[model samples]
Every structure is written in structure tokens, then in C-alpha cells.
Target: MSQADNLIQRLFSRRAGSLLPLVLLGVLTGIIASLVMMSFLFLLNATLGGLNGKNLEDFEALTWHWQLGLPLAGSLLLILLYRLTPPACQSVGLAYVLERLQFGQGRIPAANIGFQFVAALIALGSGHSVGREGPTVHLGAGIASQIGQLSGRPPSQLRLLLGCGTAAAISAAFNTPLAGVLFAMEVVLMEYSLLGFAPIIAAAITASALTNGLLGTHAILEPVSLSLASYRELPGLLLTGLWVGLLAALFQRLVLVFIRLPLTSRAVRLLLAGAITGGLALVTPQILGSGYDTINLALSDGLPWPLLLGILAAKLLATAAAIGLGVPGGQIAPTLMLGVCAGSVAGALLPGASDPALYALLGMAAMMSAVLHAPLAAIATVLELSLSAEAMLPAMVVVLGANLLCQHGFHLPSLVITQLRVRGQELQTHPLRTALAQRYLSELADMSLVEWSGEGAPPRSKATALVVKRDQHYYLLNPAQLEQRMAPDTLDALLTPERRLQRLERDMSLLDALRTLQDDTGAGFLVPVRRGRGLVTRARLVHMLTEEGGLY
Candidate 1:
């Protein structure tokens, strides 16, 4: 690490203690994230539109042969891309981002970000039934993480940047700044406080403004003002929530099936996903791209019963197959498409006159909330889209109700959590472990330091402890031992070879440190010595966790 990185790491060890710098960094991160999203959307549109003199259209206008062959061709290109990329750098998307931020310190490699940029373009541009939001979210967070990694920030500050970038991405994609902030908190951080709120909010707002100004787009969806028809519709609303919850469960279950399949080869998985998408597109072309046109059509009451029913079955299966089989794309836009279709169908069947847009809105909130277990984010999305308080009442009822069914009735975890679990990274179920994993190692570093590694008489300092380096290892010497003449005379002898310590990187968290210590219970932590840098022992981690009400 550079000296500047070390300086920033040590400076922000106490999370959120520096609000000014955090907010400033949040703005910078948001700006970068917005430019990335603008480019992503432009490139995707230009590629899809360039085929037939259409300016910015999806694959809906494509020839039958192009629609049939694009997904398969995309898979072939991805196979070539994957073969050239290293296995370690192959991981992309939100789950991959969560793994890097939550498990290790928030040091996302730049190469993965680069791969996602190209990979998402191939997956979405080639008519895979996935969304652009996922790749954009990954891109935003990855860029912020790269900044943090370069600056040498601690995990806490780095985590803040990660959240900021996520918020910016979602904000830019959907033009919902509040939803973006909540998503960063509710989905990524999995915890929240005022310390996180300011920077996240700043990032979300900045990103939303930048994208809107640059792209001349605002409120991508023509969200209508909606309210309940009557008290009699309460039953219908309840049924709608329950129905949407069932769809959410089915969506997750389909992905789960593909995930658990015996097919082990990445090549087989990608090709099979491509083949399934191609087959489904033959049945209904609506599942070809991100399906934004379908979503708009549903909200406008344009889809007929047969078409709605067709999309209900085909899009669900196509998205499940694409995502479950490990396509490096996002599921958010697809989830919205599925929700709108399900909601429109539910509205048609319910025994009351209703606006199709209202049902579509409710369905969007319910499925998104239930599947991700993120009701607040869903509600915030509804409120922002509607720009009124009317959407909140029903949004809450259906959103929370569906979440209850998906979590309690179906006993399902969030989709993102499921994505992690399938890859053998279980949620840190223990509250304390999860808490510690969010904290940094520098918080427990020893503050007192009196280096005596020189050959002279230790420079005559009044420090209480003597620390020295020998053979690139740090040894904690006793000042009392020196006073009693029991210690070795020379600095070389003062550093004994008795017990070697593990080299702990300055970026690791307390949880990471503890895990390393667990490998050899006899070993302790020894940070590389720079100017005034001190060791962090195993006992420090224990003390941080077991102290007065820290665990409880």
C-alpha cells in the first residue's frame, strides 16, 4: 500500500467519524457512476437500434431470424469472453459485489468491472431476458470500490462508497433517488444508521440529476396517480398481495431449480440458458430483451388476455432459466416485467372495476418487495414514480402483505441471499458475526509505539512498550524486561524467533482477522510496521466483540 492509502485507512478507522470527506467522496463517486450508466444505456440502445435504422428500439422490431439467433450468438461470444478471462475475475453482478464487500474488505478488482461492462452489453444487447440495472449496479459499485481501494480507505468508508455507488446506479437507472438510497441500505449494507444515510442520499441525488440532465429522460415510466376504488377492494388488494407473493415464490423456485441442476460445466450452463431463451422467444417475442416496452404496454392497458397469459408463463420461465444458469445479467427489470404482467392478469380476473395501471403498479411493488424482501425500497419506488402519497397506502398493504407471505408463508429468503447461498456463502446468521464483519481491523490497533529496532540506545523515549522489526516480522518487547536486564542487548536479539505471527493486511476486517486466527489458534496478528504502525493481537478482536454490551 502507498503511504497515502495507509494514511486514509488509519484516518477513517472509526466509521463515519469524518462526515465532510464522506459526503464529498459520495458526490465524486455518484458523478463517476452516472457517466458509466449513460454510456451503458447509450451503447445498449445503439447496438440494438443500429440493426434496422431504428434509433433506440429493442429486439421487438427484429426479424424472426435475428430474434431466434441473437441469444445463441450471445452465448457463443460470452463463451469466448469467459475462456479468455481468468476464473477468479469471472464473477460479476450484485451477488459478486456483495461477496467482495461483505466477506473480504471492499476491494473489488478493476478487471471484474471491465468484464461486467462488456459482458452485460453482450447479454442484454443480444436479447437475453435480463435487465440492464444489474450490470449498471455492479458497474457503479465496482467503480466506487476501485476508488476506495486506491485511496486506501478502511472497510467502513469503503463500504460507504460501495453503497453510494449502488444508490447512484439504481437512481440513474430508474430515476428514483429515494429508492436507490433505500436499496443501498436495505439490500447491500443490510443495516442502516444516520452515518450511512447522508452520503447515500447525496450519491443517489447526484446520480439521478446527472443521468436525467445528460440523457433528457425523466420518469421512464408514465406512472399514473392511483388510489383504492373503495373499501370493498380491500379483499381484492389482499388477494393481489397474496397472488403476487405466490408469483415471487415461483420465480425464486424456478431459478433455484436451474441452479441445483447437475450440469457442472459453465459452457453447458451458458449454452443451455441461451437455448432456452431462444426457444421461449419463439413462443413469445416479449421475453427477448429487458421488456420495458411490455411493462409500458401493461401499464397502459394495451396487452390482451391471451398475450398477458402468454407473457406470464414465458417471461417467468425465460428469466429464471437465464439467471439461474449463471447469465451475468440483472433480474430487476425482468422482475418488474413479470410483476406488471401478473398484476394486469390479476386485475382482469378480480370482481371489481379497476385501472389496469393501478393493478400493474401494485403488482410491481408486491413482486419486487416480496422477492427481494425489500418492502421499503419497493414502496419508495412507488411513491417516487407516482410523485404523490396515494400510492403509499396500497403500496404498503400489498408490498408488506406479499413480503409476509414470501417470508413467513413460503419461508423464503431474499433472492440476493439465495444467490449467495447457492454459491456456498451462507448469510452471516449470527448477528454479532455480521456486525463484526462490517467493522475494520485498524479499530483495534495498539496506539502506543516505541520502536527500538535501531542499533543505538532506543533514542531515549518515554514510551511504555518497545516494538522492533526483525526479518520483516514485528515483535512486541517488554519495557519492564528491559529495565530488569532480562531482555536481549541488541535490537536483533530483542526480536526473538520464538512465535511467528500472521501478516494481516491493513484492509481486512475484524471478522477476517478472526477467521485467519482460527486457522492456527496459537498464532496472533502482526501488521507490517510503517511509521508508528502497531500490532493488532487476537485478544483485541475478542475484546471488541465481548465487551460490556457489545455482543448483546
Candidate 2:
């Protein structure tokens, strides 16, 4: 290796050295993700402007025929695009990123990223009632994974980079850096620690700064002046939370049902979804695209109760169908829109409580928390976007009610986890396993012993463990076993089936190595360390458990 390569390797091999590089990487990830998301937004807006001479989200300006035709054409095009692409490259969005993190060692295909960029543009630009955040996440995580692979980092570090990218994407997309960090921890990483938190926070800040520099400091949602009028309004807020929780549950159930449908053909599914969205769009064009305008309207209390309910019903069906039918977009915006309408309706129904605007904000928090099973992140997003401290108590109450309803009453999993299950993959998380996976077997293997000779000779070294070779197989022999076998003078005794040697790679995680050791009762395992093959036994695990404080 070159001198620089050697220096980098040595630096990363140390814990302290690992931090600076990862933090720098996180910054780079944020900048790149922000640029990518900005480009996506520009392209989408430019396309929409060219087509309709209206704002990117103003599908309402489109003629009735165009509203119906755009999604239908886009669906047909998506079907053709999927057919042309490889099946491996067809997977996109948050669930795909999670699946790769779990089973693919944070390796995302470049083709999938490219496909998502195009597919999301088409889906959103054509008013498919899906949000762009999902594609932004896929693109961002893909970039980070690619960078990590190119850097030749270990799987553990690669996973961290993936989280960094995910946080960066959300930060840039919504201009909510805190929410980005929380989302990465709660939804993507599914765990949090000081080590992971630092880099993710760095990434979120970097991305948010870059996004603001390029796209200006405009929030994704309009800032609203709202608050609970009185403490007595708490009961009404709780009721709104329950209402949103039910809607969230129903939305999840609809999406899950569609995902699990017996239909196998992608084109057929897209066609059915397009038909549903088109039918809904004909009635209420606001249901098309991410419906941010609809949300703004609800927040202003501009839409009457009947109109708000109609939009809510249409958006719910359209978004559920779009997601269930495999549209390459996000559900974050849709959930926000749903929350706004639900909260507005509740506010209108409950007399003398608070402004409908406050209820809209609370509903947004509740739906997001319930559907995604990420209450902390949802609350963070609301606080960051609304910039209203007064909204916090009501948001918390609503979010808690929604969470309790979803978790206890409905027993529904998070949206991404549910999708993962439908794809036959289970998300695994354990504190010990997570800790051990960060450490390689080489770090814990016993390397003090010298190889053992035939029975007559004692081991040259004073090491407690000795490696004995018999018939091309290696076994770890303790001093007692060595003494016991000296009288027998038979190598065959040490070569019993239970005492057979097993091999482990130095780069393998301690957790994986320990799992292998547990599954097979061997004399010991031979780990190919940097210097040479080293002997590892149950004692190594004991050393790791005892020496590595806080691992559990």
C-alpha cells in the first residue's frame, strides 16, 4: 500500500482516529445529498412549470382530462421502465435502504439510485399523490453506501454512513435538522448512541445548511401562528389524537393489504392504482401530488368542513393506492396532509377549544407518530417546522394518544418494518450484537501462544493456551489437557469429533464468531489475524465480555 493508504488505514484502526474521518464523511454526505435533492426539486419544478405554467404542486390548475391522463401515462411509463430495468435495480425507497442495511452490508446499487431519481420525478411530476422524500432518502443513502464501499470501510462504519446519508436527506428535504437526526435514529438506524449520534447530527446540520444556502430558508410547510386557547382544550386535543390514530391505523392497513395482494404483475398493479388515483383526482385535484397546498389550506382553515373531509377521503385512498401499487415516492408528506385534514375536522366539530390551525398541526404530529411509529421524530419535525413552542404540549398529547392507540389497540408495526415483513425480511436489533458487530475477531483473539509439539515436549511459551496440530487440523489445548494427553501419547484422542477445529476470518465480527462457536462444540477456532492465524476459544468471549465494559 502507498504511504497515504497506510496512514489512513492506521488512523481508522484507532478509535479516536475513526471519529474525525467519519465526521468528515458525514459532512460530505450531507453536502452531496443536499445538492442531489435540490437538483431533484429544480427538475421537478421546471418540468411542472413547462407543462402547466403553475406551481410544481398545483395540479388543481390542470384541466380535468390532464389530471386523469397524467397519472395514467406515468403509470404506463413506470411499468415499461420497471420491465426494462433489472429486478435487483427495481427496489427503491426507505424499505429498500433498510433491507440493504440489514442483509446487503449497506451496499446499494447505483442503478437503483438512478432508477429512483427518474421514477420519483415521473411519479411526482405526473401528480401521483406521493411525496418526493422517499426517493430523496434512497438517493442519499445510496450515495453514502457507495462512498463507504469505495472507502473500503468495514460493514459497521458503512452502516453509520448510511444513517448519516438518511439524516442528511431528511434535513435537506424538510429543512429540519433536528428532525433529520431523530428520524435517522428512530426510523432508519432503529437505535441510538453517542458514537452514532455525533456523526448523524453533523450530517443533518451540514445538509440543512447546504439546503438553506442553495434553496433559501423557506420551510417545507408554511409557518403558522397557533396555540391552545385554554387548558380545558386538552381533552379535545386528546380526542383529535385518537381520531388521527384511527386514521393512521386504517391507512397502514390499507397499504399493507395492497402490498400483500395476490396480484403478481407490476403493470397490472400500477394500472389499478392509476385508475384509483385518476378517479379520485377527477373529484378533487388536490389529492394529486404530495398535496402540500391542501395542507396549507387546512392550516389556514380556508377549506370548509365538507370540502376538507372530501379532500381527506380522496387523499387517503389515492396515497394508499399509490404506495400499495409501488409508486416510487414517500408517505411523509401524505401523512402530514392527512393529519392536517383530520385535525381541522376535529377542531371544527369541537366548539370553543382552539383554532383549527393548532389542531391541524397536532394532527400532523399524531398521524406521523402513529403511522411511522416514531413519536420523538414526529414531534421534533412538528416543532422544527412550526417553530411554535406553544404547539408542543398539544402535539405531545396527540402523539402519545396516537402511539398508544397504534401500539396497544392496533398492534401495527412501523410502516417501513411492515413493508420489510411483506418482503420476507425481519429487522434485527440487539444491544450486545450491535456492540460486538463493531469489533472484529482479531481485536479479541488470543495470540500469546506458541504452536504445540508432540506429547513429550512441554510448550515453550508460558501462555495459558497452546495450539496443537494433528493431521493437518489445529486445536487449542489448555495446559491441563496437554498434561492429560501426554500419558496417552496419542494425537487421535485430541482429534475427536467434538474437538475438531473451526476456522474464522479476522475481519468477521465477534458476535458472528461467537455465534459460530456456540453452534459447534470445537476445541477452539483458528482466526486468521493480520500477523498469522491465532487461536480463539470460549476464554476470548469471556475476556471480551469482561473487558469490554458497557457492551451489553
Candidate 3:
């Protein structure tokens, strides 16, 4: 083993009380997950070629192999996978990672991982209309969760480590380390902090190195040449962005609508989705296997105009059906395909048209941004994938625009919306922000009230109580009022039940505390901390909220 690997292994020796152990576990999990994915991918390729007698090119051929052969093969493969694996493994692969986050590390059973791997392989090999990223992501998370469980990490910490595994998988898959790290923070773990950054970055870099060692330097799409026409084209780029964003919105809606068809039999659904993909393949084979060949072909500017729209619609429908049928795969490939189509179509409409290949590259990034709601990652991905200035500059604008449209117009990315739906959370509002607030408040609610501060104090305070008062501009009690109210029965009156008593922590983030306070109608609530705690009067909390713009 290398020094880092050895170091990671040693840290896990004393599994308890150290973050080092979790980091080490993340690295190990990432490496193992990558290897497992590679093996599965290789087997899938071989099976498609050897067992099924279908090569990569066969995926694009207009034949019954995809229509009939794929459905038959996929149905049998799914049946075998379902029979061999547990019932819980049947959902889309990414669902497994989300389940782990909400439940616990041990929630993802080992059998589920094996099932997902096998099922994803079968689906991909059979030419089911799904992407690879989702399966790999789930595989990585399951592996990391297992590692964290073995090392005895807490659920919360393990969740973060799971994010690390997710980051590693993306980095390995796309060779985009920064995007993977950002995705880990933004999507998987849903938090951003120095503490969360370390393990994810380490795991991402480690997995990237390992993946590079195995696969060398080829990306999914070939690098294409791009040249800026002129500053005059900037306005046209903006128009392209608008079109890409709209296409992305349409894509998201289609996926959701199809996936919710409520087909009674999953087997039937798989066959149906396969049949649709096969028919599309019959028309144009370029839509198969991440559409790498078609994307490159489209990028060449030599592709006949007659086939562009048909291929675009076919790939879109195929991917949507593939995922809707509960197949295990990623959405990244489909997202890229959508972008290519959108950009190619948009570019064709422009005067003094640019290279279609350049547009294809831009479309991939723009569509990804819309689907993922991560403009930076999308832009970076295009830059890395194309290595062309023309693709990068326009791609950034397209991604930014698509992200804006998706967030404000459509509300949220499809994955986040799907996750919220699965959790039974309302999607019209910010459910995650509410969940975050609730989690924080729940933790605070469990603590004992230690002290009372802020606002008027009761005339009489108990022996254990620390009374605090706030005047117009100061926190000290009004001495004049205290003296004037100092009656023999003053202490007794202050001790009455009507008087308020609550404890609050000052260090709590205002965002969370405000939400907690809003949920209750009491004058105030008791908050506790390891150190000194104080009461935050209802008025003060309300004032804070008003100033902060509103409750979560």
C-alpha cells in the first residue's frame, strides 16, 4: 500500500473518537467501490458482446436486437436481479444514498449493494435507457456506509463520509474532482463547512488517481475545436442559454411525469421502456450507451440536418423511459445528450452559425447545470471535457442561465425533488431548510434550560434561577423599577405561574432558532448549551426574525 493508504489503515486501528478513522474508511471505501464498479462495467460490456452477441455499435443499429432482444434480456435480467436481491434494492440507485442519509449507516444492507451492482449491469448491458452515474454513486455510498459502520462512526459523521464516497465516485467517473467535491457538498451531504470539505476532497483525489490509473485519459466525449466568432455573438450565446434552460426544464418534467405512470407490473414497465428504446434505436443507433458516438457525430457539423431532431427526440424519450421503468442508472448521460440537442438545435438557428460540435459541447454543460442546479460544476465539466475555449465560455453562460431557470422557474433539480417526494416532504416550499431547522431545534429542545436572560425578569427569582432584564438600550435590570417594586410580597408575585421562564443559547444560528421559535406560541422557550445559556424572549426572537427577513 502507499503511504496515505497505510496511514489511513493505521488510523482505523483505534476506531473510536477520531475523525482520522472516518477519513481512512472513506479512502478505503472509495477504492473498493471504484474497483467493484469497474468490474461490473467490464462484465456488462462483455455480457452485451459475448452472451448477448451485441457489441457497442449494435446498440446504435436499427434492429430488433434492441426492441425485442433488449426487452427480453432486460426482463430476465431484472427478474434474476430482483430474485437474488432484497426488495429494498429495487428503487433507483440514488435513492439508496438518500435513505442512508435519513436513516443510518446500517440501513443499506450489503445484499442491496450486490443487487444494485448486478441489476445496473444487466440494465446497462441490455441497453435499458439509463445512465451509469446513478448506479456508481449508489455503489460508492453503500460501500462508504459499510466502512463507516465497521469503524463505529456515528450516523451523522457517517453521512458525511457517505458524501465523500459519492464525491469519489463522480470524480472517478467524470475525472472532474472539483465538480465531484462540490456535488458532495451541495447534493449528497447538503452542507458546506471546513469540517465537511476535508474527507470529500481526499476521497475525490484518491479515487481520481485510481480511476486514471485504470482507465487512462479518455473522457466520455471527444475534444472538439472551437473559435469565438466575434463579440457580436455574445448576445446570441445568451439566446442559446435561454433555449438550453427551457429544454432542461422540459427534460425534468418529462422524467417525473413518465416515472409516475403507476404501472402495476415493474417487469412489464421494464419491457415497455426497453421496447421504446429499441424502436428509437431502430431509427437511430446514436442514442445508445451515453450517446458518445452520436454526441461526437453531432459535434462534427457534418451530421445531416434530417436526423438531428429525430435523434434528439428519440434519445430523450429513450432515456426518460429507461429511468421511469425503475432501471438503475445515472441521469448525467441523458442530461448531456439533451444539452447537445438543445445547443445543436439552437446553434442551427443562429446566423453565421458556429460549429455544431462546439454547440454539442455547450449543450452538455448547460443541460447538466439545469438538471443538477450546479452551474459551477457544469461549467467546469464542459471546460474539462472539451478543452476548448469556445465551449467553456459559452458553456458557463448557458449553465448559469439554465440553473437560474431551473431554480426559479421549475423550483428544484429533479433529484432533490424526487428525494423530497420519497421522504413525503412538501416540495412547494424549501422542505430541506425546514428539515434542517427541525433537526437543530429538536437537538436544542432535548437540552435542559440552564439560565434565563434578555427582557424583563420576574420580581422574585428562585435560588437556581438567574434573572436578567433588558431596558431600552441596555441589558441590566432597571434599578429604579426594582426598588419601587420591592414589596414584601414581590418575590411571591414574581413566582406566580403567569410569569415566563425559558432558556436560550446565543451561539445557535439565528436561522434555525428563529424557525424553532416560530413553531411555538409560548412567550419564549428554554435553550441549553454546554456553557452558559439564556432566555430569548419571544419578542426578541420575533424581532430577530423580522430583521432576518422571515422564518425558514
Q: Number of the top candidate by lDDT?
A: 2
lDDT of each: 0.79, 0.81, 0.64
- Give the worst 10-residue stretch by lDDT in candidate 2: 8-17
Error of 3 at 474 (Å): 39
For model 2, state the Cα shift of residue 235 in Å.
0.9
Give one digit per residue, the lDDT tens place, for model 2 in 1-552. 578656556544434335787887788889888898888888988987887676557888889898898899989989988988998888999999988876676789889999999999889888888887788789989988887766656566788889999999889888989998998888887888777888888899999998898778867677887888998888888888999999999999989878888899989999888888988899998898888877877776467988889998998889999999898889998999999899888988987657888888899999999999899999998888878778988899999989989989988888888988887887765766655654555545567777765556656567877676776766766665555335543655665756666766435666677787778777657777656876666666667578734132
Quote the lDDT for 477 in model 2.
Answer: 63
lDDT of 1 by residue, 1-552 (tens): 778777766654434367877887788888999998888877877888775356243566777788788899999899999999998788999888888777766778899999999999999888888988778778989988987776656677888789999999889877999999998988788878777898889999999999888877757676666677776877888888999999999999999999999998888999999999988888798898888777777776567867887998999999999999988899887888888888888878887766767778788889889888778888887677656567677777778778888999989998888989988997664666877787776655665657665444554556655666566766666665564333344545645544345556564667777787767653356554334465665666677577764321
**Residue by residue across 328-438, what tens digits does model 3's lDDT show?**
777777778778777877777776556666666777888887877667667776776666765666777667777777778767655545645745753333655524432
Clashing pairs in 2: none
Off by over 4 Å in 2: 1-17, 429-492, 496-501, 504-516, 523-537, 549-552
lDDT (Cα) of model 3: 0.64
